[model samples]
Target: MSISASPKSRLLITHVLDFNSIFLFKAQVSRQSLGVLRDMKAAIYPITRPTIGRKKIPFRPYNTFPSGLKAEVVTFDE
Candidate 1:
């Protein structure tokens, strides 16, 4: 899909591997389409859990990925 296309036009990424806490994904888009793949950095925070009223705390596992790509985390490192 073209870069100008909407988010839905993004290629499907079925596999996502957390390489030593860094997320790396493979897209359905062929290499010939984009020529070269670039690594993207992003933040992936943990889900916040409810708690008593007090100072708020940040989450962990802040990961990143390419923008405008549609992917599913089929498997990941623990």
Candidate 2:
């Protein structure tokens, strides 16, 4: 299953909590689509860490792979 977000949705997802929602959404969709045995992918904008004061704290979850998935992040030439 391929997941995509619109520009408006992407804007809302920039927040830390909203970004975390993406993971939940992914997991739910994966479960529902399991019967089809389709590959799961999200076509969202590159995720940037939110800032606290002048420093950008890391979003550690972004560095790890999703559970039960053998996936990799691929970048394209811009």
TM-score of each candidate structure, all chains considered together: 0.15, 0.15
- The CA lDDT at 65 in model 1 is 39
In candidate 1, which residue ranges exceed 4 Å CA deviation? 1-27, 36-72, 75-78
Query: What do the candidate models score in CA lDDT, each in turn?
Result: 0.28, 0.27
The sequence of per-residue lDDT tens digits that candidate 1 reaches over residues 7-72 is 212122222543323323333433333332242221132322222221111222334333211122
Alpha-carbon RMSD to native, per candidate: 17.9, 16.8
Task: Give a tens-digit lDDT track for model 2, residues 1-78.
Answer: 234421111111135564333321111122323423353352243333322112122334665534312232121111
Cα misplacement distance, residue 69 of candidate 2 (Å): 4.9
